[model samples]
Target: MAKYLLLIVEAEEAYASAGEAELNEVMEAHNAFAAEVGALGAELLGGEALQPTPTATYLRKTRTDDVHIVDNPAPELKEVVGGYYLIEAPNDEVALAAAKRCPAGFGHVELRPIWSFG
Candidate 1:
């Protein structure tokens, strides 16, 4: 099986002021997604929600050994990676199908196959 990373990309401002009920709905949807994906044979290795991009630290690297850690990316982006799931699937198609079922209510999902060098 191969590993895939489902990057949850979304606008941070939307969730920043989410009402209590809205938050509950999102949590419930996530729970349902977890159960549904597991039934489809996708093993969720690990996943987590990240802090806002405002809290992100960007490491800028150069060929001449220049490196600097900044608060965010060089060109600030509107959408940020809010969360991610590391899943193991039978193949690329299966991984994609699993990602399609994930509950990314207000935003979209990005599925990428993890490169294994061994």
Candidate 2:
């Protein structure tokens, strides 16, 4: 089987304004999506929900050859990666099909195959 990563991209404010009930609903949808992927013969290897972008830290090399560290660097970005799922499937078709079942609510899913040397 081949591995794929489903990147869950959503608006930065998508979850910030969500009520408790809405969050629960979204979680339930995610549970159903996971089950559906399994039913389609894909193995749900791993996944996680990320903290908001404001909690992120970034490191960059400046032109002066110095490493600069910044916190909450991209709050201006309208959309951010909210989570991801690592899955193993029989082929591209299966992986793509499983990605379609991901619960991305007001955003979208980006599916990329994991590179393997062996």
Candidate 3:
């Protein structure tokens, strides 16, 4: 078995333009999905929903041996990483199965294997 990180990205419009009722519905669905994933015996390490991008910060390395820090996200896109999940599964297929059940409106879920150091 291996641990994978499931990155959940939500369409900016779905989030930014969502009303309170719509947001509540999405959140309810997400919670249900999470519970289902947990029942599958996959370890849920941790996860969280990020705030809006306006509060994001960016940093980059410069050729002058300096690190330039900025006050916003690197790129302005229609989608933003909203949350993530760390799960243990036998293969990518299983991980993907869980990710597909997430409540993201026309959004996407990316699965990446975690590198174990030990």
Using lDDT as the measure, the top candidate is 2
After superposition, the stretches of candidate 2 with alpha carbons farther than 4 Å from their true spots are 62-65, 71-75
lDDT by residue (20-110, candidate 1, tens digit) is 9998999898888788777888898888889887777778785557887765554566677899888999998889888998777768999
Q: Model 2: per-residue lDDT, tens digit, 1-118? A: 9999999999867688999999999999999998899888899999999997767778888666788987666667677899999999999999999999999986999999999997
What TM-score against the true fold does each predicted structure earn?
0.89, 0.89, 0.83
RMSD of each: 1.9, 2.4, 2.4
Error of 1 at 10 (Å): 0.5
Clashes of each: 0, 0, 0
Q: CA lDDT of each candidate?
A: 0.85, 0.90, 0.78
Scanning candidate 3 in windows of ten residues, the lowest lDDT window is 70-79
Q: What is the lDDT of candidate 2?
A: 0.90
Clashes of 2: 0
